[model samples]
Target: MKKLVILGAGTAGTMMLNKLYKVLDREEWELTIVDQYKTHYYQPGFLFIPFGIYKKDDVIKPKSNFFPPGTNVIFSPIDRIVAKENKVLLEGGKVLNYDYLIVATGTETRPSETEGLKDKLWYKDIFDFYTIEGALELHKRFKDWEGGDLVMCIPELPYKCPVAPLEFVFLADDYFTKKGIRDKVNIKYVTLMSGAFTKPVASKMLGELLAEKNIEVIPDFYLSSVDNDEKKIVSYDEREIPFDILTIVPVNMGSDMIERSGLGDDMNYIPTNKHTLQSDAFENIFVIGDAANIPTSKAGSVAHFAAEILTENLLSAIEGRPLDAKFDGHANCYIETGQGKGALIDFNYETEPLPGTFPLPGIGPFGLLKNTKINHYGKVMFRWIYWHILLKGRELPIEADMSMAGKYRV
Candidate 1:
């Protein structure tokens, strides 16, 4: 039997396993998935973890629960990928050969990448919500905390869920208001980008909202290092922003194995054909999710869209046919804007977010690029859909390709 090996049983890998399991003939092909951890995290829920909206247990489940029974699930850390030999070497010294390989190993937070960021003040005054431990620790610190110079900063771009840091700032504003400490807190958002967001029109809208909320915005601040003792972030240009409490979204990079295999770019992301989702270095290998150096948002929705195209392309390749299925960098994200309202944005490689009614053009239950309660509910309801539908590889009502049907083009 031909071996089909998938690395990292996270959202992307798990979904692919389910999709391919039903399609690949069991007698002729064998599927194997490997990951170091036993538990799977609903990563999107991590955004709410620091706000006490979601407990750690609420976002975690056994990795084995979602995987197909027939596929071999191995809990082992990958030491390196010997791509030349078409094999993965685990930490335990086991070598697994593959007829075809899928690299879904996702990105990770590198707090140490910034000097002094992980020093004495880490988790005391500085915290990150990207990891489970950091979120839980921040939750505890936020409970008894009185407010002062509360700064939410993003060190650089291409971070997981580009809007997450903005969401954190919005949620923090609401949290402090509810705790009766809003008056005492000076809320500030510092980012490397030129505006509140990457896109110009959306950034303008969001910037206006931030001003109305009285949250200060500091743009074009390229963070060089953190001064833990002084409680300030120093930029490469020598500019400094002082903070009483700092919530940081640090540097994000792809899996270490990609670097070890010499198959990744400067940020450790594999160089993949943006439309094909196939590795530029090898035809038999493919990359998806945060592992691919694609221009789309490093988001779950992008991965879902990529999976649809990849499924078709993989089948075509196996049949010695041309791969015609193309990924258009589709990404849909819900921005939680505090107070019981949220905004939705949908776009692809060639398009920026625009104002529109979503899913059903004129009769949308959700609005795009505008804050609404319906969008908030959609954001809240996604957690249920993630475990029940997305990870299970079930088809969702939304189309895989970006749609202009419900969107209003200017």
Candidate 2:
């Protein structure tokens, strides 16, 4: 029987496994998945953990819980992917050959990459909400903390969930207000980008919101190092920003196995076709999620959309046919603006977010590019949807392709 191997049992990998398992004939194919970790994290919930909205238990589950029955699941660290030989090397010197390979090895935080950032002040004064441990630790620190120079800084770009840092700042404002310490807290949002966000219109809206909330916006400040002893962040140009409590979004990079295999870009992401999701270097190999260096948000919604297109293309390749399905880089995100409200944005490669009703355009219960309580509820409800529907590879009510049906073109 032909073998199909999937790396990483995270969101993207699990979704693809479910989608392909039903379609691929079990009589002719054997499906296998491999990962080093036994637990799976609901990554989006990580953003809410620091604010005491979610506990560590709410965001974690066994990796094996979602795998379809009859498929082989292995818990082992990958040593390298020998693409030339079409096999993977495990740490114990075991080699697994594959007829086809799907790489969903996701990105990781590299806090150590920044000098002094991981020093004595790391969890004490400097914290990151990207990981469960960091988020949980920050929660305790914020409990009794009197407000001071609270800085929310982005160390670099191409991080997972780009809007999370902004979300952190907004939630912090709300958190402090509840504690009656809003008057004492001085919130500053420092980013390497020139605007509040990567997209132009969204940035303008979000930037204005920051200003209205009295959150200082510092753009174009590239982080150089952290002064643990001095309690400041030094930029490459020698600019210094002092902070009493520092929240950082550390540098994000793909799996180290990519670097060891010598088959990835400088950031260790595999170069892939933007539409086909197939690796540029090999036709028999495909990449998805944070593993692919596609010009799209490395967010969960993108993975869901990509899985639909990828499954179609993978079948085409197996049948020796042309791949006809095209992926338009569709991505949607709910921006939590705090105070029991949120904003939603939907766009693709060619379009920026425009104001309109979503899912039914003219009749949307949810508005796009505008803040609403409904959007906030939608954001919160996603955790349930993620576990029950998304991971099961079930089709959502929304279409895979970006649509203007319910969106207003201004």
Q: Give all candidates' CA lDDT scores.
A: 0.92, 0.92
Q: lDDT score, residue 207, model 1?
A: 91
The total number of steric clashes, by the backbone 3 Å criterion, in model 1 comes to 0
**Candidate 1 structure, TM-score to reference:** 0.99
Give lDDT tens digits, candidate 1, residues 1-410. Answer: 89989999999999999999989999999999999999999988988988889999999999998998799989999998888899999997999999889999999999999999999999889999999988888999889888789999998768899989889889999999999999999999999999999998789888998988899999999999999888999999999999999999989999888899899999999999999899999988999999999998999999888999998888888888998999999999999999999999999999898888888898888898898999999999999999999998999988888988778766
Q: Report the Cα lDDT for residue 281, model 1.
A: 93
lDDT of 2 by residue, 1-410 (tens): 99999999999999999999989999999999999999999999998888899999999999888999999899999999999999999999989999899999999999999999999998998999999989999999999998899999997869898788988999999999999999999999999999888888888889999998999999999999999988999999999999999999999999999999988999999999999999999898999998999988889999999999999999999999998888888999998989999988998888887778887867888889888999999999999999999998999998779998777665
Q: After superposition, how far is residue 176 of candidate 2 from its true place, in Å?
A: 0.6
After the best TM-score superposition of candidate 1, give how far the Cα of residue 254 lies from its true spot, in angstroms.
0.8
> What C-alpha root-mean-square deviation, in Å, does candidate 2 show against the real structure?
0.9
